[model samples]
Target: MSFSALPKIGMGTFRLKGNDARDAVKSALSLGYRHIDTAQAYENEAEVGDGIVSSGIPRREIFLTTKVWHDKLRASDLINSLHDSLTRLKTDHVDLALIHWPSPNDEVPMSEYLGALRDAQREGLATHIGISNFTCSQMDQAKDILGDTPIFTNQVEVHPFLNNRKVIEHARQLGIPVTGYMPLAVGKVMEDDTLIRIGAEHNASAAQIALAWTISKGVTPIPSSTRPKHQKDNLDALKIRLSKEEIAAIDQLDRNERIANPEFAPRWD
Candidate 1:
């Protein structure tokens, strides 16, 4: 499928485990979510696969994404781990496979691992390949390495609180898509009075307003929910058309907050 064919709303599987993971996937599928995101680091691909099976959604109808963890970015290790991920996912190939995080301390060169990722696409292990948690410089390095090969999307922490404008702009400049992870700011958006007021005006929840705001910025938001109500609510967020003033109001909510930063994360642009 074309990169532009990617769904506007995706169900994320971060921090979701066991029944929480399985049922959430099922609920999301039932609620018309065709994109599902998970990572090898998430340690629930088997459950996610089970949930997909239980949902009775045809595998061809779903856009599934899985990631290779940082520790496994070595070329051979990446290929091996992806094979293992496909085994766990009970699928021959994922719709997209990502480098979960950049090599910690650059122990593994981007060229080695990213080339292997491209090889996987050539081998039909992944329909598309991408990078996650990559900085602007890292993205440039990826471009230098991949050349004509496209990096499908840069999956990064993005929300009203952390608009991630720098990376988003760089990715867009390179003709890459930006997939916003943690689009709700990890529940903080629900407490923001501005979001609540906006939600009230639209008869929606604060979470829905935040999601709608995120989408308005031309980034795809993958908001996860174990509850069917919230899944439906988030899917419904796409229908919301924020006025220019409302978009500006939410734009003011950017505080440079980033939720997915780890000690080994690269220096931001």
Candidate 2:
């Protein structure tokens, strides 16, 4: 349940669906992406698996992750859902498995749902355990349920705009890595003059600069794209280190601009 060696740069497959999703995954692998993120809700685990297969990369070398849908929080149902996902993903085991969301109102108790995830680890379906879209308190509750099992990460939306400073700080204090989804804030980075200026200095795109900023803050950014150049540009950020002043300037752009929020998502206080 610990990810001491999880890749810092990974591909996020949230909105990528169908052939577009498949092509994106294949392109990312071709571009040297060793980590991939997908979920049952994304409806593209199969395509992701296809991309891995097409790339001819051995399954063990890629850090594959998938999630159990929010509706399948019951103990047995969650385990079964992961099994189905594994089948579609064409992999026997996932490097990481996360609870898609903290379904506070799900039929099962939090303990049961988290316990089911632990069971998945015991059965060798998933190697690590984590959660997504969880608020600070919800993460605490999840940890309580998990007990000694290490929670690998808490994947949440974090961009220069919607900083989620409180949650990020809390997670840092607890030593749990925060994986920043939508790190570019859905193209909002393109409009940020400060980030653009910094990118210009580094000869990188604003998207790359924003992604670098995420890693600078010790959070892993999972930016999704189907374009080969864009994906390659994203990976390039890992090599560019932003100066302290640049990091501070980008941090000043925080305006609570969150891009993804479903009606059922937990409200971040």
Residue by residue across 1-269, what tens digits does model 1's lDDT show?
A: 44445689899999999999999999899889999999999999999999998999998889999999998888888899999999988999999999988998998988999999999899999998999999999999998999998888999999989888888999999988989999988899999999999999999999999999889878999998899989999999999999999989998988998788899998876
Task: Estimate the lDDT of model 2.
Answer: 0.88
lDDT (10s digit) by residue, model 2, range 170-252: 88877678989998888879888998899999999999999999998888888899899999999999999999999889889
- In order of appearance, the predictions have TM-scores of 0.98, 0.96
lDDT of the candidates, in the order given: 0.91, 0.88
Q: Pick the candidate with the highest TM-score.
A: 1
Q: lDDT (0-100) at residue 257 of candidate 2?
A: 78
Clashes of 1: 0
